[model samples]
Target: MKRKRIPNKKWAAPVLGLALVLPAALPAQAATPAQAAVKSIEFVGMNAPAGAQQMAQVYTGASVKVTYGDGTVKTFPLAYKQLFKSTDSVGGTIAGVSVDANGKPIMDTSAPNNPVPYVSDAPDANSLFQVPGMSPTSLGGNPLSLVTHYEYITSNNAGDSAYGLVPASMSLTKIDQNKTTGELTPVELQKVDFSGVDGLWIPCNGSLTPWNTHLGSEEYEADARAYEADPTQTYLSSFVQNYYQDTTKKGNPYDYNYIVEVSVDQDNKASAVKHYSLGRFSHELAKVAPDGKTVYFGDDGGNTMLFMYVADKAQDLSAGTLYAAKWIQTSAANGGSANLEWISLGHATDDEIRAEIDKGLTFSDIFETSDKPADGFATIKTYPSGKTEYLKLKPGMEKAAAFLESRRYAAMLGATSEFNKMEGVTLNAKDKKAYIAMSYVEKSMEKDSKGADPVDDIHVDKISSGVTYELSLGGGQKDRSGEAIASDYVPQTMKGLLWGEDLSAPDAKGDTAADDKVANPDNLSYSEQLRTLFIGEDSGMHANNYVWAYNIDTGKLSRILSTPSGAEATGLQAVEDLNGFSYVMSNLQHPGDEMIVPDPLKTEVLNNIDANFNNRKSGVVGYVSGIPSMEQIAAAAPEESGGGQISSPADDSLIPLRDTAQAAGAKVDWHGKNKEVVVTKGTHTLRLNVGEKTALLDGKSVSLPVVTQFSKGKVMFPSGVWDQFAKL
Candidate 1:
């Protein structure tokens, strides 16, 4: 059944209430029940950036719906909070940046972790590249204190050929949480030193492992085959020269382009390790299955292959068997559907691969290649950027070829290498499903000409905006070799869930795609508790990229966020429960990027950004706020239903003490000596004497309308005192 699509419009009203569903009619009553559950939350979508004043604005408001156990429904308006910006200094250094003494970014091999600040020519990051991946974690801290550890990745230093060479850095921040309203305040930001693994390269989207570690990726890996042939090559091979600070030293391409796992200690110190067991490629991100042993990879870039790794033991990624996907297309409509079969590409241990890289094993030592057809060489066209080559594996080089030249070898063995711009992978553990974001539905994904060199398996119509495919997970499946797969989390089939709508012509805002739907969906994160998938866009087609919330059960798509014009929406991490509160992390990169913006509106967008974001030099790392806890939302219904008295926090005369005080993260204590009540949050304190219409605030006596009292063991206080706690 086709679901009705929600059109995009400029929300005229401050709050738009949307009730997803309601329960059956309840008996008429004098009051509604106190306990209510959150039925669904639908955020209002903002219009495309228009005039100069609105181009750099970020929407931070939403409407939430709550349903009580007795079937009574209500709606609430909430606002999002901004924690910090990229230009904000952390431990005296800007987030995701490194500079010299003169404050100029060092892009050469003079020092490590410092690259060209600004990148042009694409609708991507500006001076401060996006913090694409963030993992919010708690490291054995006080449960009541609400302390969270956040580690985010900076994708690259610059765009075009200068990308993937300079090593990227991951930053760790300690945040203080307010339990009452679920607000986050940053305490400190520290760079997680990656020199232990010779620094990180192009770390992109990442995920948190089941054991609580940040699993990151290194995208656009330097071509080891090309570099081995011409050691003096300046473009891609310069990654080693820049890192070692010595161009004369022999560079080893195998040392980079692997999954990097970072662990943070209780003191907030961080350590990293590169998992070479995972095959080298243009890795966007990897998602570990609920079972921990099965892992899925989203290899970014053109002509990429879908890869999976199954570890020998749970929680250990050191040794695993790698497999590539073969798409058996069942339908070519709506981004296509495929029943997948895995082809084993061999496996090895991380220690062994590291040893080979240390020994300086070149590409020629692993395989023999020829320009024309030969007796031993096989026709394989799986090189990065779509290069075809004739190659034959040498004896005893199976493990080397599998780990280093994974894509080329996979194609030689009959695996699908036609996926374009596969960006991020996320799992819906509750439903046993996984999602992969295809940033572009073009190139090899489309049907080819009759005389094309090699036939392609995936042949779907082009949708420039992109598609997010959902894969069903199941067990008892075998690989193409008929060998029993060890893990039960293998994906069986894949189909499109959220697809973008490409416009026949440019819209008024010069957007080539519909402003309402997702365009170039890149980042994905799923919340099992909410049954919603959060998507972030990396689109050049849309004037202002957006972040969306898609509810799986109801097929409802809500545009929850919109970044500044020319900026990419990224850093999407959804936390279902953090000290009883829920949060969704959505960040922006490169405001006022004018790569694809029409010439007419370029000056307006730039001027607006200059007024708001320091001349388009800032990017934000923050999360949506005001999300009520599931525990608070699941209020039980009274057995005998009645019309409940509703009280707005803004104008209520009387308020319940327990709910109000706890919601404010304030502690309430009974004082028996004076027969009074005491409330405290931070440094502020309030004391109320029973039967007296007066209160003491910070030792100053203040008049109150009503005296503090108790009703059936529940404390009740005047709503006027609410402001005293709020100010704290």
Candidate 2:
């Protein structure tokens, strides 16, 4: 593979200045009749103008219809306003404002707002009486008590150009529903801050911990060597020292990739704390089990491995014992099942590791310099506090080796490190199983190898799709000591339950046939009550990535929601409010409308672009309700003489297209060749294509889940389509 080289222009400036200055200082004696004139060559570099691409219009205040497995559909209108403009206020605090030592306004209290009365010894001591353009009166009620707070993690897809030099952050918000009108309002709290941790880099999907804190993962950190070598990156040196605590080294590779815990108090004041003991790597998500002691993490990169951290105590992840997983290959295919065993990579407290680094002992020095035995074990000695301790590294390494060089240490410890982008781990506590999503199972991970870059060494006959594996918790399996482990779930015997078929390459027609495909499963969430798993996509191969629900019992996958063009469906979480309404909180990230357009659109065409695209907003978080089953909806309805209209059977309720056309005073025609039904009412016409969810209404594409249905030899359609078509 050839790499592009950046021209070295540093010497150009000095050489050009020297040439210009020397000509004027030339001595008269040196100027001879036969002296040749100095020939000057000028090199001009031209910079092209920043090109603009066609930005897809962001859909705001729009309703999306969700079709269930039982043929029941529900529509959820945009609950929150499209978050594109930087100044568009979502939510903030009014009462907690106070002046800091620097005279800057800050939220003083971290107390969560609840029904319980709040008491302060000096309530008005350090409080600010007023703030310009902000109300003095506080909205003191606990707005988030009933509603779940969705902290959306936004990534700067456009790199430094999108959000300046700082890494993108997460936003905390809650959806409020109006009881009478059933309208939803999105209340924005404060944007999460990392404080002294500097800024996060490419924040990805995270997990809501058992203690209710958000475990945010940072992806794609800068290469340690590159950051240290570049003089312009000197500003990051202090940040690296603060996190890595290695003053002897210019930049530590151990910094900036661990899972950071973010907590939002009742007043919506957010704070962050990094848990360095969890072992740093390119983390995708960190899911805590029901016990809250064991946390499973997925590394989202090539040559990565599954990692687990068993905390010293429940709900406390600050200190833990880290381990890596080794898969016992039982099959020879991409989706093949494998029995898993955990290899202890050893552990140490954060303070102990920092102390070791202070003693000028790099994590690499302890393991890399140790002598290995023929039996595949190394004995490394360590002195934490003047007392020498020996570590019997089975597949041997240092105690702090896993925390510093996690991926490399795992591979050396006989753990499977060939997984390509292992992403999104979730637990099905009810079934005592853990589910992991592998985005596109590569051929390299299908076999065991000792070579570095196993991906290149293996042969891939066919391009494999993404797959979700279900691993059983230890129910009857015995550990190395032959002791029966009870519910001590380590990932073992993984079976492929769901496959993202759309990840396959495009066919001869340049079409992927992705209608039934759910490619690139990125974020996953499991519902205990519903026995369903929610899968979100992060792929550009599809026209619009979608959020799907896969029932564990029935094996039915439903495309519940689709995001706007050029955006990924992220942050899929299910929560129940006090009103008993189950809602799926989801985010649409980096909509396509923000991309640069190659050919500029005409003024008229550009004007049609939604105003939301006029500003730079990368993502939007919203909630989807009305997701109950048809039977549940019907059961909840009140009894009446003719029964409730919404609960009636679809066959009797749906009206024929001919009858609707006559009532609307429109002409109807059926095109057998195209398998389309055309209905024209005055100047407006709708083309309903059979077996397709999309319909063309007056030259505009509209999604109608069931555009036309056949009932009793008559072509019938949902009556709801009439109401929507009439408005158009």
CA lDDT for candidate 1: 0.65
Each prediction's TM-score against the native?
0.76, 0.60
Runs off by more than 4 Å, candidate 2:
1-87, 91-142, 145-165, 174-184, 196-199, 221-251, 354-397, 446-464, 475-487, 502-513, 593-612, 615-617, 629-728
Best by lDDT: 1
For residues 1-728, write the lDDT of model 2, one tens digit per residue: 00001011010000000000111011113333111111111111111111122223322222333322223444444333232222234554311111122222322122344221111000000000101122111332213411111222122222222211222345454434453333345455444455445445445667777666778776544433234346244234533332233445354445467787776654546677777788867777688987788788877655567788878888888777787776766664546666777777666676665554455544435443323333444322111111111223333336556776666566655676656557778998758888888765654454434443322222222224467778887546544334433336666677666664542455321224253455666778876545667777655344445666666654655555655444556666765322223456665654553221223332322343334432323345454555432222223322321111221123324578878776675656564434667775422456676667566654456655454676786777667666555432
- Candidate 2 achieves a global lDDT of 0.48
Residue 187 accuracy (lDDT) in model 2:
51
What TM-score, to 2 decimals, does candidate 1 have? 0.76
lDDT of 1 by residue, 284-369 (tens): 87789978899998887777899989999999999999999999999877678999999998879999889888878888998898
> Which candidate wins on TM-score?
1
